[model samples]
Target: MDFLERIKARKSCLKACETTVTTVSGHSYMEKILADGTSVISWPQASTSPGYVIDTKPDLQVAHVLPGLCMGSQDVAHDFGLLKNHSVTHILSLGVKPVTLDQMLNYTYVQLLDLPETNLISSLDQCFIFIDNARQSGGCVFVHCNAGISRSASVVIAYLMRKESMNYQQALMHLKNIRPVIKPNPGFVQQLKDYEKMIFTLDGK
Candidate 1:
């Protein structure tokens, strides 16, 4: 199916979204502003796990895309305490900015110059290596761009496709299932489909 068709089919999966944050008390918390301009807070984490699942509207600041993985904006990248709280062992910067938190702690840092219009297939292999290494070490990797919707999300969806043996549709569906607001650009979406075809051809599928 084409990108637009896929989007139309999956639109219903995204609704009633909010930004999720975990409190020091080990509860999932989110603050929302209603249409009437009233602030409402909710704590839904009656339990916790090694990796907390965040289900809410896509906030560029941070969204837990999957277990052992997250995608966020540059604001999240600069927040040392947030990274530490989430036990993020690696940071993948998918923008031109030099990662400032790399030397602040012992975290592994990988930077790639990926623009919204840039084709990402060439960098997938290298990026995959860093992400895989972090996961194997029982650590999580946070991928981010200026905005989490396009560049960073594209890199992450590519990783899931290549590493997890999922096709573009499946990987994207899974991503949106977790983080509802991810919408990669059309060019990136096409590149992912191309990458999917390449993987299938290599596997003789």
Candidate 2:
């Protein structure tokens, strides 16, 4: 990167690096937010077995899209704790049923809307509402289903496009930084491109 870009990147990195000082023999874990302003979910493991850590940048508000069963109690709790550091105050699950605090911490959101299905259009419409509320409240939000993939990424890109003025490529790259495998399904990716085109047509860009 250019010198100025490097400097700016470093500054953001510093801001996102909120390290946990305390350590527990087994429970303690350290996290540092990515330059995109999302948390890197890490837990140290024993020498015998190593596991992958979630190093995500919740640059913009986030979403999760998965089957109803994926957001179980344990995973919900994990996401809830990471939410604090990522500034994720509002949780939006695209699944039909809401994720209860049996595992994740309780969040007092204005409302949680469960849609009919995981179509691109449905995801976009829900994103509109969350983006509106989040902007008004000045709080971070999240969208998830099971694994943080296709549906999550699609809604996230919509939020970026409508709110952050990110073009398709830039928005996709940003999501990649947060979750490298954030590959929205082929059909969904096409829809996002179409959304970009719709904006371009309106703006004559």
Clashes of each: 2, 11
Model 2, 97-193: lDDT tens digits are 4556433332322222222233576447655676566546766555564455666667777777766788999888876775676777777777788
TM-score of 2: 0.52
Name model 2 segments beyond 4 Å from true.
Answer: 1-79, 102-118
Task: Give the alpha carbon lDDT tens digit for every residue of 86-192 in model 1.
Answer: 87878877754635665644343345545446757877777778788877888888887766777777888888887788899998988777767688888788888
Q: Candidate 1, which ten residues in sequence have the lowest lDDT sum?
A: 104-113
How accurate locally is residue 159 in candidate 2, as Cα lDDT from 0 to 100? 70
The per-model lDDT (C-alpha) reads 0.73, 0.56
